[model samples]
Target: MSVLSEYYAALERLKANKPIILPKGSAINNDTVAMEAGRKRGSIKKSRHAALIEAIEQAAQATGQNVPSPAQRIEQAKTKTKAVKSDYEQLKEDYEKLLEKVNSLLLENFELKQKRI
Candidate 1:
């Protein structure tokens, strides 16, 4: 499997609450380490962003300011988040397509050699 595939699989396994075996001397025994790593990697930021937006809405209500509805705020956040995620997804798709093209070329090259007898 490609490195990306392995990494994606590992992430899925981690999400599924499966134990991910680590190499000797690696710090994977403590789940907190992984959790902290994820938090530092932007998951915490997303959660905090959501909480802050909610708080802002609440404060707007308390102050009698004309604030957008909660749904509108959520939709706005989603719209902003979609742009970032779409970039990553597009890159991933491009990479996968490149990988497929390379594999096809390799197979075709092997077939051409086999017919050279």
Candidate 2:
């Protein structure tokens, strides 16, 4: 089969919601599909292969088929970041208080040592 034939076959598998494996044996993703098809990844993003790009996007975007969209993943990351920041702020406050307590205890210890002398 020709390279073009393999490329089209990959697209058909994508349309059928099948996976495309890259040269490195990685599972197909938007970033890796062009590589899997022996094409430049820029072809998909820069409108070099308009129809193929659209088909890939539609296949990847189909919901209720259990596929996760890039947007969903980004939103999840943003939510997680917000939760982490909140937790970090609480930890920072606790750390500052602990430092102050330790400093006070050290001061008392120094005073006790001076009195003993």
Candidate 3:
């Protein structure tokens, strides 16, 4: 089969969640479609296959396959990391406060025992 036909078939298979080569529930993007078509990951280049690329993009949009770009993924990761760090800091503060309270209670208990001796 021609490369274009192969890609289109792969796209259909992906849309139907029945790809032969890729895992089930694979996202409908250029790379997944290319790999499903038995081609390399970056085989569907815009310079070489502009129409195919456009078709894949349109299909992905139509099917609601909104895969994030690398930059978008990185930004999402950064936001998650920031939130995690903030939570960690809050936990650390709470731990320190608890530790201080425990120490104070221990000291008071020791003083009480000494007075009863």
Candidate 4:
């Protein structure tokens, strides 16, 4: 139940790609890893947690696993979503322009038919 034990457990979970369970039964992630490990959020910069963080990074690198930390994954998802949303907006604008063009052509054709009648 010590902080060191929690830190080690978190490291193992990271290596195995398992979720780190917090004391309150919440799943651990990058943001919560330090807190779950009995340290402040910014404590990762501290000497002890810094070394642990380095170890985790090295382990992941050595294993050739691309398991992204939660923060990284969230940022990546946000970027992708933004791109998709932008594309969708552009398509919507194009569709509206095409519809307007079609309506204009239809109106002009109707006026010609009325004159012929």
Winning model by lDDT: 3
Clashing pairs in 4: none
Which wins on TM-score, candidate 1 or candidate 4?
4
Better of 2 and 4 by TM-score: 2
Tens digit of per-residue lDDT, candidate 1, span 56-97: 345445545556667998999999899989999999999999
On a 0 to 100 scale, what is the lDDT of residue 55 in model 2? Answer: 58
Report lDDT per candidate.
0.52, 0.65, 0.91, 0.69
Candidate that would win on TM-score: 3
Best-to-worst TM-score order: 3, 2, 4, 1
| lDDT, candidate 4, 1-117, per-residue tens | 877677777667655656544543333334456665556765565565667666756766665746677899999999999999999999999999999999999999999999999
Cα displacement (Å) at residue 7, model 2: 7.6
* Candidate 1 wrongly placed segments (more than 4 Å): 1-80
Provide the clashing-pair count of each candidate structure.
Answer: 0, 0, 0, 0
Where is the poorest 10-residue window by lDDT in model 2? 22-31
Which 10 residues in a row give candidate 4 its minimum summed lDDT?
Answer: 22-31
